[model samples]
Target: MKLNKFWATAVMASAAFCGVASAQQGYPKQPIRLVVPYGAGGPTDAVARIVGQAMSTELGTPIIVENKAGGASSIGTNYVVRAQPDGYTLLVVAANLVLNPATGIETPYDALRDLKPIAALANMPILVAVNPKVPAKDLGSLIEWIRAQPESVPYASPGAGTLTQSWGEMLAQKYKLKLTHVPYKGSAEASRAALAGDVPLLFDLGGVTAALIAQGKLQGIVTPGAARAPGLPNLPTARESGFKDVDAESFLGLVGPANLPQDIAAKLNAAANTALKNPRVIESIRSLGLTPTGGTAEAFGSFLSDELKRWTAVAKSTGIRPAQ
Candidate 1:
């Protein structure tokens, strides 16, 4: 009787191990939901759909894209944070994930604690632009014009707790420019505001502004990074304008809820990387003025950690906060 009991326990243990292994081996037994924490037709949503479609083919399953925009992106973000760790639900968001935590934007879940980085999808160089009616034609003139204003000039950013906001504040502080921040829900809305001259100046994603600038609806001032953006070669770099210290750029990446099974995370990361490699997917992403960036799960996580640290320091120095 004792021997039979021991054998029964051993069999059960083996069966459990096999069950887990089988599940991981045959992952994505169902459709995967890719959540965007912003409105549809926005850069975040666009990237999610393009990459999600390609990943669907790689994983042999449909990748459903869903937008849960609101609360400064807290709504959809929290939705993924609370999802099951079975890898069915995921998130594709921007650098705001780190910005929210670093700038104390009051998110429902902490990104580093509640999410797992799967893979980086792309990098978007942030640009400073103004309405065509604005008197400034270049970065220097814009700075000069802002300083000469009698009152604080209004500038628009994607939202509070974003790199654009921090960068805008940094510029105001560095140059003593009297600039008032006007935060919007996302890049798409902010661009529209800038287009309608509701906001004279804007710090927005290059991907969203390239066409606007090309059509002469908006005037591009400077692209803040190490170099000029390829899509907007006519636009000078911050370094050219002598504002080389501002190296702000937006990042887009994929993430899942924390404690997700390691195997599932690896599978998703592989699929994302593979999807990013496809030629059509590459062209689609670039057409939006975003650079395709794909790497290991570990590398993406490290990037997030670095970004979190960097944004924290910026927030401390600038006293930046989300708009009430």
Candidate 2:
């Protein structure tokens, strides 16, 4: 009886090992869902659809882009956080995934703790623009104009606890300027407000503001990035404008639930990198005023960690608090 029991135990272990091997080998048997934690037609959603289509071709599976926007992106992000560790359910999010929690927003998942970074997809600089009526042509002029104003000038952002708000807050704190934040529901509304001169100053994603800048509706002052964005080459970077510490570009990436199997993660990462190499994908991303970024999973993970730390420090210094 003891010998028979030992043989049965060994057989069970062998079967379990084979099951794992099979799962690893046959990953993504069905369509993969790529959740975008923002509204449709936004930069994040655009990136997801572009990258998802390319990834599907590489992986021999359909990649579905689903937008579950709300709660400052916490709702859709949390949905992905609770998803199975299997690679089918993935998330394509902006830097807000880290910025939201750093700025004291109540997020259901810890970005660094609950998600596995699959790959870095793109980087989009935040364009600092003003209504043509602001009378500021560049960053220096804008700073001086704001300082000369008798009262604090109002600025519009996408919403509270978003990267747009953080950029405005950081600018106010760093330059000692008096700027009041007017949070709008999303980029479209905020852009409209800026265009209408409802707010004299605006900070928003380059993609969303590029067309307006071209049309003379808004003047592109400076981009908060280490370097100038390709689409906005005429604009200076924050670092070049003498605020070296004001680097606040948005990084978009792919991630999955924490503890995602290594093989599956590697497969997705490889697929993403392959898709980024496509010329059509490159043009599509650039047309939206975003730079394509493709790197190893480990590199993306490290970038996310560094961004979290950086934003946490920014939040503390700027006194940005969680929403009520």
Candidate 3:
């Protein structure tokens, strides 16, 4: 009886070990879903499809890019947050994940506590642009023109609590300008508003607005980044435009539900870094006006934390509250 019991224990342990090994080796045996928490054709969706295709090649599995946009991106974000932590369902979201909660909007999931960071995908500067009807030609002139308006000048953003809005608020505060917030459903809508002159000023991802700026419908004022954006080399950065404190950028990254297996996370991170290094992938991302950022899972987590804290402080200073 004692020998039989020992054999049983050994068999169970061996089976468990084999299961783990098999899981690690056969990860993503089926299709992987990459959920984009924004509308299709937007920067986040574009990055998702780009990285998804690259990761599919590396992982030998199909990665389906799904758009689950709405509710300031909380709807799709919560979907991923509540998903299984099996590495199959992942989220590719923009900086709105941090900016949403930082601005006091109640989300269904706690970003830091409920999600495991997989990798930082890319970063894009926010381009400040104005409608052709606006008299501003540069950041300084825009500020002065805004000041001259009898009422608060309206500025359009992708959404109310997005990083674009935060950057708009930062600019307003830095220059002590009276600006009213105009929220749109997505980048397309916001861009339309700016082009139609519904709002004189707009803040959007640099990649999405670069073409419009070139089309002469909108004037590129400044980019809120530490340096000039690669896509808009002629546009000065906020710092260069004399607003050093107005540095803001939108970053996209991958994450899974909390408690994702370490080996799986490592594998995904490695694949992402490899994809970012691909010459084609690099060029594709750069063409979209995004700088590829492939780093360890830990680094992505730290970046998210820092962004949350930074944006939270900005919210407080700007007196931004959750939209009713």
TM-score of 3: 0.87
User: Which segments of model 3 are wrong by more than 4 Å?
Assistant: 1-18, 133-135, 148-151, 196-198, 322-324
- Output the worst ten-in-a-row residue range by lDDT, candidate 3: 207-216
**Residue 69, candidate 1: C-alpha displacement in angstroms:** 2.7
Per-residue alpha-carbon lDDT of candidate 3 for residues 165-205, written as tens digits (9 for 90 to 100):
88788777777889999988767899999998888888987
lDDT of 2 by residue, 150-235 (tens): 99999988777777787788778878999988888768899999999789888888756777886777999998886778777788
Question: Which regions of candidate 2 fall more than 4 Å away from where they truly are?
Answer: 1-7, 322-324
Quote each prediction's TM-score: 0.85, 0.92, 0.87
lDDT of each: 0.88, 0.87, 0.86
lDDT of 1 by residue, 168-194 (tens): 888887777889989997778999999
